[model samples]
Target: MGKASLLTSERRNRSARGTQVRRERVRSAWLFLSPLLVGLLVVAGWPLLRTLWFSFTDANLTQLDQAQWIGVENYLYYQDGAFYGVLADPDWWNSVYNTLFFTVITVSLEVVVGVIVALILNANFKGRVWVRAAILIPWAIPTVVSAQMWLWMFNDQFGIINYLLMGVGIISEPLAWTASSSLSMWAVIIVDVWKATPFVALLVLAAMQMLPSDCYEAAKVDGIHPMRVFFRVTLPLITPALLVAIIFRVLDALRVFDLVYVLTSNSSSTMTMSVYARQQLVEFQDVGYGSAASTILFVVISLIAVVYLYLGRRQLGISS
Candidate 1:
């Protein structure tokens, strides 16, 4: 009886100790997470709340402290014909169209070119490391610097681009690539594609390198054509990474300002939503209206993010 009682006590003590250890682990995890939680709430949460509050009030920069409660007046102003003319104005629509056109064309070209470049870079070649580094040069350069370089190249009379094209007889006369509204969007697109394609290539190349060599070997042994192998084996496997890269590029393109601003000086043809918002806020000194527009942009971007997440999950499930 005494031995049995001692055994029972020992078992109970061990179980209690195990529970205590688990409790300690939980407490430690929470302790470590507490600081991060606080920081996120302070940095991100507060600003978002403030922006939401500002969207509702007539908060001008000069009279920030005296911002009157305008309720939904600011939002209504954006909906009305006079104040919201920026939305439906022909110039505004032209900017919107140009922005969309640029985004679509540039992104499509970048994806195709980037994929090809990535494939070529993945192959074994002499001086491959040097070539890869050279490819990243444009992407590594600062956006402003890249814009300036391209701007100089697009200068009609003194530009190397025009000179080269003329030397090759591509054009009979010097063309104003940036001066003409019609050509400015394409010129900016060309510059953007040049600067951004390398980034996409690097990302896809990284994904390609991570793929299993054995899969390629198996495909080769099975007498699969290179094109078929790519579509059947390679594409499906690297799709997640590709999707991630595309999402990042899309977000970057949507918020584009500096390149367009520096290159085009907020030209009617090149002004994006962000550029428009900034112009209203700074140039026009219509803070209330700008805030409302910004709020709308935020909502649109949020919706896009949600759609991306949903689609990503679906794609992940299908791939799995």
Candidate 2:
């Protein structure tokens, strides 16, 4: 071969070898990951498939073995195509509305309150370490334990909340916080905000701490106001991390079960999507209907996540 032909053949051989090596590496990685993938398929995938199947059938806890497919009757248009199945169930709709409302209010409050708390904690102050640790106390508390604790605190007859309000002359009579429909949801929201805001704060504080000090120094040198520096510089840089934290809290709040269940058990006003599904499954023994609700909840959450991610991408100028 000529000099140019020899060099070209060598380059081709090298490229082929590189491609083979990459293929082998990818195969090895997949081989190592196969077990974990199989485990996930068994653990998560199987149950999801089972739930989907049950959602379309007449399954019951007692007669689970005798599941018989009855199409979408569990979900909609059951009686003469007039009475909606779970779709027309007022309690289910109420639970959905409660979930959406709780998600919006709690997440909004958490984000705003968390940003403030993070900013405070991020500053140089005496006992800053202790204060940061102390703020995490509420987040560390178990949700059920926190719910129960708040439940007692909200007791109208002898709760500390009532006592303080009465002492301050805010109200002459003790208000029923949990039992009253008007107050029950707010009471739950208060407890959730207390329990979760610290977590969001911690996340934001970590993000804030990682930010380059040069930005602050440059802004200071330019005579920029501290508030302007925050909104313009600090907020923009930490937007990604803050978005992730908000999304996590939103998903958690959407499917909330333990706090509402433990705090207000069966209260129509406080019933969330998760609690509603459980009530149908365990309490009413309507497994099929409950599974349908569970499926719908999953679809709703998935759609919300997709929309959120799409918006995030659009805002961040991501193509895919």
Candidate 3:
């Protein structure tokens, strides 16, 4: 009976120890997670909540303390005739059209040219290291510097571009690339494409380098065409990485400010949403209206990010 009683006591002690260990584990997990939760609340949550509140109120920079709870008055103003007039204005529409046009043309060309460049860089060639370094120089240059360089190149009177074109008999007179609204947008697109294509190439080239060589050897053994192998095997394998690169480029294009601001000086033909919001908020000092515009842009970009996340998860599952 004494032996049995001692066994029961031992079992009780083991159970108690297990429970204590579990409690300690739970406590440690919470301790580790606490800082991250606090950081998210402070950095992301607070700013978003504040922006939403400001969007609803008349929170101008000067009247921030005395700002009234207008309750969607700013949003209503955006829907009113004057706001609609701004929305419907030819110059506003032209800017929107130009922004979209530039994004599409530049991104499309970049992807195509970037892929070709990546393919060439993937091959074993003489001076390949130097070539890669040279390609990255354009992307490494500051946007402001790039803009100034392009501006100088596109100058009509003393520009190298005009001199070359005139010397080649392409045109008798110097052409002003930035003077006309129609040409100005394309000029900006060309400069953007030149500066960004290297980024796309590097990303794709990295993905290509990580691909397994055995698969390509198998394709060769099976007598598959090179183009067919690329489409069926290479593209499918690297799609997730390519999608990530494209999404980044898309977001960058949407928020484009520095290059456009420096190149065009917020001209009606080149004014992006960021330029417009900044002009109203900082330059014009219409804080309430500017906050509303910025809030909308934030929401739209957030939605795009959410969509990319969903698609990325779906692709991951498929790849797995």
Candidate 4:
């Protein structure tokens, strides 16, 4: 063959090999991903799809087998030139408000207290090992167990919290911490912060340990205040891990059920979205409404995730 013909053949051969290599890589990726994809379908996707179907039907716990297609009757309605639905339900709105409030308070407290705890544990102090182990104790407790424990602590009579307050002359009467409308939500937030702050602290501590010491050393050389260094250097460096911790807490807080349910026993004041959904699904036997609530909860959580991810990326990209 001529020189040009030989060169063209070689180029085609190289292209063919490249295509084969890419095909093999794609096959390998699928080989590794197949198990996880199967697991997700079995564990999450199938149930979600079924729930979506139920949401659009007249499903109920009492007659689930005989459920009929009602077509969004549970989600929307029109009454004399007005629009109403779960979106218009005052109880649904209340639950949404309670859930968001609980999430915001607990996550904020956890992040702040977590940073302080992490900073303290990061220092070379006496009993640091024991303190670290103790910090994990609350987090290691089962959620139901922790909720029951807090319930006792917040009891109107014979509770440590009341005992302490009375001893300190803070209150003459033993207060009903979880029974009152105003205090019940705060009670839940406090319990959640107590239980979960350690996890955040430990995560942040791990991130802090991984941070380079050179930055701190340089900050010291410039005679910067410790507080200033934390904000200007440490926070920026730990943003990625902090974001992870925040996201973890946010997801958990948004779906909180056991703690509030166990502590307050479905009091409207502290009823969260998860609790409300369960009440409709299991107690009230309104499966259609319950599934709709669950679907809405999922959308709310997805929006939160997307917003945080977008903000984190935008902030990080700018800083970089």
Identify the leading candidate in terms of TM-score: 2
lDDT of each: 0.82, 0.93, 0.82, 0.92
- On lDDT, the candidate that comes out on top is 2
Off by over 4 Å in 4: 1-29, 80-84
Q: How accurate is candidate 1 locally (lDDT)?
A: 0.82
* lDDT tens digits, residue span 41-158, model 2: 9999999999999999989989999999999999986566578778989999999999999999999999999999999999899999999989989999999999989988999998
Pitting candidate 2 against candidate 4, the one with the higher lDDT is: 2
Query: Global CA lDDT of candidate 4, please?
Result: 0.92
- Tell me the lDDT of model 4 at 142: 93
Tens digit of per-residue lDDT, candidate 3, span 1-320: 99999888878898787799899999999999999999999998997777777777777777777767877665554553455323444544565566677677888888888888999999999999999999999999999999999999999898999899999999999888877777788888889989999999999999999999999999999999999998999888888778877888878887788888988887888888777778767887767666776776677678988998898889789888
The 10-residue segment of model 3 with minimum total lDDT is 80-89
TM-score of each: 0.86, 0.90, 0.82, 0.89
Clashing pairs in 3: none
Candidate 4 per-residue C-alpha lDDT over 1-320 given as tens digits, one digit per residue, 9 for 90 to 100: 69999788878788888799899999999999999999999999999998888888889898888888888777888889886667878999999999999999999999999999999998889999999999999999998999889889898997999999999999999889999899989999998999999999999999999999998899899999999999998888888889999999999999999998899887999999999999989998989889999999998999999999899889888988
Model 1: per-residue Cα lDDT over 226-306, one tens digit each: 999999888888788788878878778877888999999878878887888788778877676667667766776788778
Clash pairs of candidate 2? Answer: none
